[model samples]
Target: MKKVLATTMATLLFGLSFPVNTFALPDNDVSANSQVLEKVSLPNGGDSSQSEAGADNKAKEDTIAKKIEGKLEAKDITVWQNDTVNWKDGVKLKEDNAEFKNYLEEASVTDLDNRNTNNSNTDTNDDRAFKGKLKITFKDKSVIEIADQKLYVTSKMTNINNSKAPKNAVDVKLQLGEGVKDSNGTIGQKDNPVEYGSYRIKPGVNILNEEHPQIKNSLFNLVKLQVSDPEKYVDPQWSSGSANKKDFVVSKDNNIFTATASKLFTMTFKFVGYDRDSRKSIEFDKLPQAIKDKLPQEQKIKEGEAFEPNKFEDTIKENSGEIKYEWKFKDWNPTKSVSVSENKNFEGIWTRSKIEENPNPEVKPGPGKEEDKKERPEKENKPKDNSKAEDKKEIPEKENKPKDNSKAEDKKEKPQEENKPKDNSRVEDNKNNKKSNNTFPRIKSNENKSSSNKVYTRTSTKETKKESKTENLSKTPKYTLTINSGEYEVLINGQVIKRQMDVKPLIKNDRLMLPLRSLAEMIGAKVEWDPQTRTAIFTNKGLVAKIQIDGNEIVLSNGKVIKMDSKPLNINGRILLPISNVANVFGLTNGNTKDGIDQNIEWDGDNKTVEINLNK
Candidate 1:
């Protein structure tokens, strides 16, 4: 049994790494194959801090680490020679593999500098949020390819490594293609099939999966790539002919792309849709001559049910004015969706929204568009440093009072400020006990809230000294809660918040946990986490209301009520709000339309004056 297993290991792994034809072991010699297996090395799998990489890449490598690191398949993880962090490709260290054993043991340490200092994007003083794109490259070869193109990706850096370079080793959860055979030779997906078999490694004969992917297929879709070399591997301009790189011309036959490389040299081949290499090949469904003619001469991509185009509307307002744009749908894929074309009518919206027109060099806090580490508020406790609430944000007229000095005098004129009931009315709320300070997080709004729906804008204050608690505050606070609306840019007073997430202080399992809804408030969103369904649903006034994690459907609300569209997507055990929709919903608009240092809002039945600045 050991001999059989050893032979299987060599036949499987060695054929993938290094040169497949360098060694010699006859087909009948079981012992020789075992020797080859003995030579196969696994990675150290230890934290990047302990790895041989330099100092900067160690710290935050884990915190910044992407989902890829979790897919490794080795016993002890270790680093590789290419300076690539270990496990990025799912390779782990083995107790054996003495040939490279020293790499893990002798690995250097990355003593990280604990200073929040960066000349590039760092402003320890002003406190800014950063959105960086990371693209992972394997020996400079593309791992997950799509859009008729061979792509390269960079995983988010884990904070484990202390080195300057973002560290966190990468991991690849390599799985067999849709129709490929597994170890037990089952011939189906999620089921192991292929009973261990022996093959000569002389021809570098790598196994092909149902998708016609070669061994350790570099084109897996486990992680999305940010940038890639499209000229060589992209699909044909259409689907029926050859791709001409000169004029960026293409054929309609683009479906799958294959890459062949040797150290410095690389080449990509395009496959047609419905080609012989498709997952359909596993079924051998007899096809008509027309269908046969449509397939390419090589491997084909797994045909999908065409892209479902959803309608979208973008509205933007500036110091200048407001503009609205509508978009139509044809067939939209990820690559094509972001890439605006001449035929696509996004320019009108882009120009009006000022995304292209008014470019801000300084990055704002909150999430970045699409994947990677989204923009988040610098969790730093700023803005709350100076000034009191009423001083900065004068209450809206309805909440405060219009030009009526009479109302301002009433709130203050009461030499008896002590007798005023902390009041059940929100400083924004219905007559209920909802503390604008408690339930409202800074995005979509709070969801843990049992059915009551209300959004309030509150300021954040840090405690330098602790005092006796009051009836207004339920308990001694661990973290302050603040809620802001995306209607216009939210402000505690007149200060613009870098983070838009609503921060809620709650007692969960006895310990306080800040939920996504509160976090959403800071960034902007009314988030609801459903324990019954293990899902999170986010809603906003006129943006896309989406269900995530377990969201099976998405609903877009132009300005109406809640609704569902397509099935929600599950990602990283957490649901992701659709980028465009979520951003739009949580985004703040200018609140005060009238004149202002602060607008006059009337409160107390139009008797009080609250200064409301629409959008600060």
Candidate 2:
């Protein structure tokens, strides 16, 4: 997915922010935030000759407009920042998901906001209208704010395995019926998406479920179920997680999506095995008469519904690699149950065959038996050998055991009470040996002294006296882990350490990227992981700020205020903060030296006045 803005954005901005949508933007046309740019849509292009006949000017306008939009939709459209344009309908065009995917993959690592473009002042073509901004990308690397609600997007495209696409791709996991929330599309009713939606993988698909704020080769379609609304769209069943309609059972568990149909003995998830985006085309139509007839009025023979009508019952053949399950209106049959060939967590590899690690190991497999066995791999019991224990017992020690005759010898060689000091020497020798044999992993020492000359221990367990003595090698006064329950960059005292916005999905050296996890452990929060969303959402009565480690929002649980660097930032899974900054707004932001970090700002304090260190 090429994230390039293709033609120079200055040119695009000139084109978009101009008085007329079709006119060229000259360099001298540059303007600031106050100018209002007019919006004149292109004429229609539906059958040029037909339009030339003057069937109607409005009709002609629609045609021409669609043609231009078609071109823009094929690729993403970026405009100057903060240039607000209130377009009715066709005046707006869509950016290609591919480019946005690539851009985000790059942005996450580059510590790019991929948000708050309204702050950029250098898009030579930025005018009042057509705000010079990047076209809205979907949910993967971008988190669209609809009504200021942080919504995710699920997107997928092809050739992932061994394919050099993206690595740290943000995967917006969705429940069986959730849709992603997106703020950048034509949702019509509101300016933002109402509820955060998610995606369901259906029956047959797999994706790079590695990291968040992801990198991707393509966000089109290979094997992925992106739950997105562009407006964070939700489905009818979103509210209803499970509904038992007589013989039809639709349920989703873990991350594996499963749809079970009784009469058909079939699951309707194979639309993707064949790469068809809609399940109604295949699964909905195949409903049996007994099943179809028994369907409720809301469930049967509907028009204008998202589901398609079936000729009969839903029959789908899905493969989980190791085992293939074929389902029809009656029941499902296992076609073949061979060992899955990829990661053991993903499959059942024979120990003899080294599990060929797939660069793009399929994370989500379609239907059948994979639902319960995805996250927790089915453990195979490896037989243990007891020969070593038996051999040791048989040898009675390889050096040979000392018999009763040696006991008398030991007594004869024993020293008297006056030799106690010599005995203490042996004890000291044992202590020395133990110290020499100590085998512990190396830990980086956090002992650098600061100007205060006060020794501070970073580990949270040093409050106990025993621990204090072990940690008192330095003179820095000890400090406690004291961060108000709000999203904030990991800091020590007033000094800045790690600046983060969204600390949700983090990783380092291939480990669970933990800021909240460690913080939670330090502060004590009953940690809970929602398998459905793959989100590490936890609750603590002591107040844990749901800080946007990647975003600028450090929402204090108690609703206190903190000045911020900018808004909030969503950087590569970790919510980044401006170390020296604070946050009070309902959103996230980042900062520049020009916009210096704010510390404990009061929005009402003379209109959000920020206190920044001027001395640098």
Top candidate (TM-score): 2
Residue range 296-392, candidate 1, lDDT tens digits: 2322121211111233443223332353222112111121111111121111101111123433322445444221212111221245422333442
Q: List runs of model 1 lying over 4 Å from the truth.
A: 1-186, 196-518, 521-572, 575-616
| Residue 89 in candidate 1, Cα distance off native in Å | 38
Candidate 2 weakest ten by summed lDDT:
344-353
Separate clash counts for every candidate = 131, 115
TM-score of each: 0.15, 0.16
Scanning candidate 1 in windows of ten residues, the lowest lDDT window is 344-353
Q: CA lDDT of each candidate? A: 0.28, 0.29
lDDT by residue (tens digit), candidate 2, 128-200 = 2212222333323332211111111222321222121123322223222224322242122222324332332
